[model samples]
Target chain A: MFHIYCPYCEEHREEEEFHPKGQAHIARPEEPEACSDEEWGDYLFFRDNPRGIHHELWVHAVGCRKFFNITRHTVSYAILETYKMGELPRFTAEFPEGSLSEKVTTEAEAMSRQEGVKA
Target chain B: MSNLVAQNIRTFETHPGVEISAESPLVFFHQRSGAPAPCTESRVALRERALLGHLILRGGAIVLDEAVHSVLGFGLPAYPNALSRDEGGERSIQWLSPDEWLLIVPGGEEFGLEGKLREALGDAHYAIVNVSGGQTLLELEGEAARELLMKSTPYDVHPDNFPVGKGVTTVFAKANLILRRPTETRWELVLRRSFADYLYRWILDAGEAYAIGVEV
Candidate 1:
């Protein structure tokens, strides 16, 4: 079983301790009033079911009880990244050292960027 | 007018196996004579009351360090998984997390001690919640207590890892408990109110082979 990382618990718990929440990187429409019906439909229902390197969200509902995103290989089940509820996932060639998504920056900066989002 | 004489008598039967003790901040249950105990009881191999005070302190440790040093005569422990004992060695405060602390004073003095801490803090962004009622303390003594805990929890409870004076919030037998060691022979389990009976029954079942006894 895959070991999922719980950001709140700050530990990699057994897969049994987590539950799949939904797709990640869901950006809210900046102006819903100005958007088309197709755009609204895409926002509401459309999601990527990618074969490899899919970034999906999961919740540590049984452990720390927090939501986080996981960049995992669907076939191999190898997780590339596990980020906190609101932070953006960074996948750059320069940062070749695959990190455990530690919050390496200031808390204030992270909090301000995610002001309207509910964690 | 002739008044009719009537006698009102109320009779109810309390089950002998379902013995509930007086309400304390915490309570424990254990069965005797190898008899089938109630479901609420943990059926633990052994159980006893841990007669110590427990208090939850919340605030920035850096800010509250000074007050704790002045009033308790010892600053907060620096280590994350450690506890600081007082001069008498009877009182201690364990760092539950970065922002939370579990303070244990002498039994029967926690309420007044909390008031003293409030006075000492003096409007700091801090909170001291009395959680004694929500939990009961179970003192697991005797030689096999350590082994029993190892079976109950996943954490390594060996003396090397869990030395005396250390406390940790860990899972124990399908439930959560704050485990602590006050002395060399004593181990404490801070169990929740709702799960006390379940845990108690589990303990009785586990400790049966060891010939563990129940204290009240």
Candidate 2:
């Protein structure tokens, strides 16, 4: 089982102790009042697909009851970092810099994995 | 007080465990005299206290790290899921979500610490909240402490998993807190203020077979 890092517990607990919250590092649009419908739709629906390090949000639902960000790799299912909900995750070139790219990669991989499972 | 319903809970009259009493704030419970006590105040033989001081430190790790190191004489842990502490282990700082941590100091030092952290952090966007009154502490000792914790919490309390100096904020029954094993024979349960009663009842009922008794 993957050892998941709980930001609230401040410890890497057995994966059973946590629940994945989804793609992490989401930022609300600046000046939403000035955005077009297409912009809003893209903001709501778009995501990135990557093969390596990704950022995602998770909640320690059974632990601290707090939301936090995590830097994880989809292939190895390895987590690089866990931070609070509102904070920006420190990023490196090896890892996609923000939520948008990470989300795109995550969705693409998830779909491919689902298809593989089906096949 | 008049209209509140009395909670019915099962309590043990005898148990093979250490009895820790409140001698003072920040005092350690001796293993020699550690035993659970029989209390009538709330039908809780072993009252799980919401103890000590709880402060949430929020800010950039680099900036907050400097502040914590300078002000508290300890550093904010760099790794996720890690706990940083003072020499005595009396005070501990645990990573509580990125850009945030939970610092447990002596019972009365929260306000001062918060002010100091703010000063040390300067204009960094950070937040520190004092939650001492909102929680109580319960010290569970004796051989049965670990087993009892397994019953109360889903997280593994095994020494292999939760070695001494390690602390976590995990689910306990229906609530949560900063759970730590500061001493070899002791387990500290930092509980919230409002849920103290419910947790007490749960512990007494679960610890019944162990003959758990409260000291103070």
Candidate 1, residues B1-216: lDDT per residue as tens digits? Answer: 011111222212211233753454323233223434223333333454554566888899877788778778898878665778888876778777657788777666776666667667766788777765566677777777887887777766889877887776766788767788888988877777887778877776777766666654
* Tens-digit lDDT string for candidate 2 (A1-119): 45776655556675656777667655557778898998887778787666787777777665556777777777877666776544445553343544565665576467556543111
Off by over 4 Å in 1: A1-74, A79-119, B1-22, B25-47, B50-52, B159-161
- When just chain B is superposed on the true chain B, each candidate scores a TM-score of 0.75, 0.73
The parts of candidate 2 lying over 4 Å away from their true place are A1-57, A62-119, B1-51
True contacts kept of each: 0.00, 0.43
Could you report the DockQ of all the candidates, in the order they appear? 0.16, 0.26
Q: Please state the error at residue B75 of candidate 1 in Å.
A: 2.9
Model 2 residue A91 CA deviation in Å: 19
Supply the DockQ value of model 2.
Answer: 0.26
Interface RMSD score of candidate 2: 4.0
Reference-based lDDT, residue A83, model 1: 79
TM-score for each predicted model, relative to the true structure: 0.66, 0.60
